[model samples]
Target: MRTIPLITVSLLALAVLAAAGCNRQPTPTTGGEAKAPPAAATEAPRLDEHSYAEPDKVKTKDIALELNVDFDKKELSGSATYTLDWLDPKWGKLVLDTRDISIDKVVGERADGNWRDLTYVLAPTPDKILGTKLTIAAPERNKRIRITYHTSPNASGLQWLTPEMTEGKKTPFMFSQSQQIHARSWVPLQDTTMVRFTYTAHVTSPKDVMVLMSADNDPKAVRDGDYSFTMPQAIPSYLLAIAAGDLVFKPTGPRSGVWAEPAMAPKAANEFSDTEKMMETAEKLYGPYRWGRYDILVLPPSFPYGGMENPRLTFATPTAITGDKSLVSLIAHELSHSWSGNLVTFARARDAWLNEGFTTYVEMRIVEDLYGKERADMEKIVARNELKKEFTDANRDLQPLAVKEGVLKDPDDNLTGTVYTKGAWFAEFLENRFGREAFDAFLRGYFDHFAFQSITTEQFADYAKANLLDKYPGKVTQAEFDAWLHEPGIPATAPQVTSARFDAVDAVRKAYLDAGTLPTAATTSKWTTYEYVHFIEGLPEVMKPEQLAQIDGVFHFTGTPNGEIAQRWYPLAVRSGYTQANPAIAEFLTRIGRRKLIMPTYSALVKTPQGLQMAEQVFAKAKPGYHPITSGSVAQVIADAKSGKTQ
Candidate 1:
């Protein structure tokens, strides 16, 4: 995480993402014959479409860049030029998206290296880069291409690096996150998730600067005593990163190292001791850690997200050191990504569950092995409740996990417990059905097969179907994956307790309640969940609502009421006896918020103006010891409601 001071990206950022045109390059083939595609067919092509086709391997892509970074000011100033091969051969327009930026320079040319005759320069505006009627002509499918450009740091994540693990004068510290800021403003590429690439980023920083790409660092060379490093892997354009800062290194665990600010390297080594364990567990489970050395450098606050898994060197949030290794699961999660998310890129952002879920899945298993199952389970319960609350409160219904890659409205939406928890459950389901032997085998196999490759949700599903269900007896089906991945709903389940010998499920419920473990009350089968609010709201709708209420009430008859169940059952206890379930509701209301009636999903709960006002007042007035999620959700509700309010 290179700490970049937010300043102006002085000129040179002339990437007109708003508009771009396709220019083609001809390449020699097996027959040694070479030709360029027709100009009409290779006209302006969509950035994403140019990369994705019905195939497994990617062809070589040539991109040239020119950036001018101010050594004294820590500012990046430059513009970019590009030439792309057209697969579709559609003479449309070239467009790029930039945020909080302006195009300061322009240069476009076709493969022939001529300015106006071969290619055309487009318009770079506040929104897009458009050229009047520029058309690209090329062959139908495969063709060699070249794009050249010049730009400077005008965005959030652009960074300059040195070898000393520290910030400095020439390359103070810089890294770019194009998600919130614009990546295209600094470098030139096919800036969409739709197009995954194996790129060779020939970054020309200061002669004394050391640049780190999101691939394995091959070796460092000095041109006229200036530092340069070549990256050794193919990664997505989004995953493409550059860390230019004063860096210091601590080596460990066979090629694993930590690159930190020169001032922070020693402290980072002492603090990141857990990384050794994280790596061992991660390596044991996933395939061999690919990135030659794993290094983490701290970055500024605006460099959002827990960490950016840039191959071996991960960019981390400085806040990760809560002074405890307890939170280091983030380390494991990111490291685990060496295989799951990084190696096999997600088809789209909506299928983000694949990234997060696989990370979380490996994280739990790693933590359980490193720490214990009890701690893992405790974390699971906490995550479950948090996720449950978010899904319940938010207006946006859950989208299928296998969604096309893109951002959800609230970036937070993707990390919802629905994705993490249920997504973990999806992994757990695989492990339970296939056994760890087969499960790990499949994970390793999948990664090995698709390393540095792109895949679709269907392709991953196809892999699962071919490897698991097709081989196992009564294994999980594509239908199950479809239902969970495509459809959004709380997993429909409840405390199922039905058997040939049992007369009533109440006895089983009692047994389950008495014992902390789920009762083996029924024959082995699937499970369902009980959303307490809906059941309480439509009391008469259940198979036996009153009995269900009474049965729930018994759990709250007497207890400390501090645990998750007591917090809920106490309210049901109050409701059961008086109406259907009396004691539980009363206790919760009286002890929690007597005036605040339980509402449908806490999200909708505070939508009313009055509700939000009351909530804000209560939140501010409430004791500080209360749960953070409870307080945060209430605050979010109040804020959304007030912002949505006319006044």
Candidate 2:
């Protein structure tokens, strides 16, 4: 998963960009941006802090599963059969991580081709967040064990949707979000990124629904109730995904397609038409597309996250289908994951930058190749601003590119701007320091060297010392590399990314702020979402109702069809007490569940007394439809407001 940080501003407090120089004519700078003194650096956590399964003792090598999807009960009753590789010859038990799952029985495959019952224990959960430990007595000679179980109605990983929650409101839908250790809620496994396994699944759903997985898929396949899929390459447990719905498919290219509800299939196919070109560009930059076929499943509005790169099939939010191709960069981001995240994996959650940062860097390269350098620079500028805010406002301990041991209580904590934006900034720093050609060559070699493997930050550092830093003489020192990895806040020596188009946008914003001049369509008509976000971010924190009304009159932001622009503009409306955007905000909250877009708006709303009341009113109706991942976050925002814990 890739994280896009939320930029929430306070109505009563001054905005950072505006307070810096609202009236000063803005100019793009071309050097490293300075920041506050950095906190002491810490070593990367050696252990996967979020998992209880010790893969070093006995690891899961392969899995075969048979599951039955029960929409009425909102549960999945299945049997997971695992083929294990006992690294410890004397190991007596196979312990797996599970959450809210009722175990029916455990059976072991005997050497005589017969199955015998095995005694098992569901140990008391050490941490409620980590769930229970399923320990089974496995004979040293036996290599296979099967557990028949059913998921809880409140399983954190699975979301069962009623027909009404979908675009084509005729059939029920179901999907899984397993990232950050939630996979245990549905399937018992060694739920750690350090463990990789090949899997084959036989899943049965309602006759009217279609099923797809993170495996080779046929867009033209018939919608039968039973579906069997196989993923030949070994992958971490989080990449395990399944979606069943009333969906239709449309081919975007010879090897790429789109899966969406009938009403959305065409729009999604059109929006992501450039996906094949992006894949080709990435292949040229790195290596071949190892996933065989690249397809996108444009999930319903309730799908949480911007996109989940689930191997061959990427689960994406419908928000990306913005009619225009402006949002295709998200497609590029997910496609790049085939090389960075899926092919070469991160061993632990703290080393998530290995997955997300590399993917983000590759995503930018693809965008620059497919689109233009200016567009890529605009994105880099957006990320740079987000990272700058993280330095000033985020927790110091969580500000490092590599999080320390035991600092993370939940795996989701790894999805911070420090891991995504700051990590990408470091990559940008390297490319700038050692010429782009050298850095590109290094990346290509790095991926090829570690293909189909999971590695830690320490391993990456050792590899980089040998291959990149050693190869490029005096470009960067070990101290600088370590500081970039472990230190809090970006180093003052980091490269600064500037965008010329954004400088022009800032000049327009300064003119509006200084002379009360209204922006004309002639100067703003061709602006993309990046310009809109920058202009909105530079606006005065507090504005008169008429001032906001005048801007809304020109931009019609409240009713804009673009979700990215709506996310940036809604908070401004809330802070300025512009009641006209209230209906649209409520509609957006109810219609979409992407946390990156909604969290900031909700945070902004809770700061004001009136906005808090409205937020509560809208959330009361919208909360039930949201995925567990998203609802948990928004619920915390609302709870913080009620407890006067707004930060």
| Candidate that would win on TM-score | 2
Roughly what TM-score does model 2 have, to 2 decimal places?
Answer: 0.91
lDDT by residue for model 1 (464-542), tens? 8888878775767667656767666444421111222222233444454455333342431222112222223222222
Question: In candidate 1, what residue range of length 10 has the lowest lDDT sum?
Answer: 1-10
Cα miss at 109, model 2 (Å)?
0.9
Per-model C-alpha lDDT, please?
0.49, 0.82
Badly placed stretches (over 4 Å) of model 2 are 1-46
Clashing pairs in 2: none
What are the per-residue Cα lDDT tens digits for candidate 2 across 463-513? 989988998889999899999899888888788768889999999988877
Per-model RMSD to reference: 13.2, 14.1
Query: What TM-score goes with each of the models?
Result: 0.61, 0.91
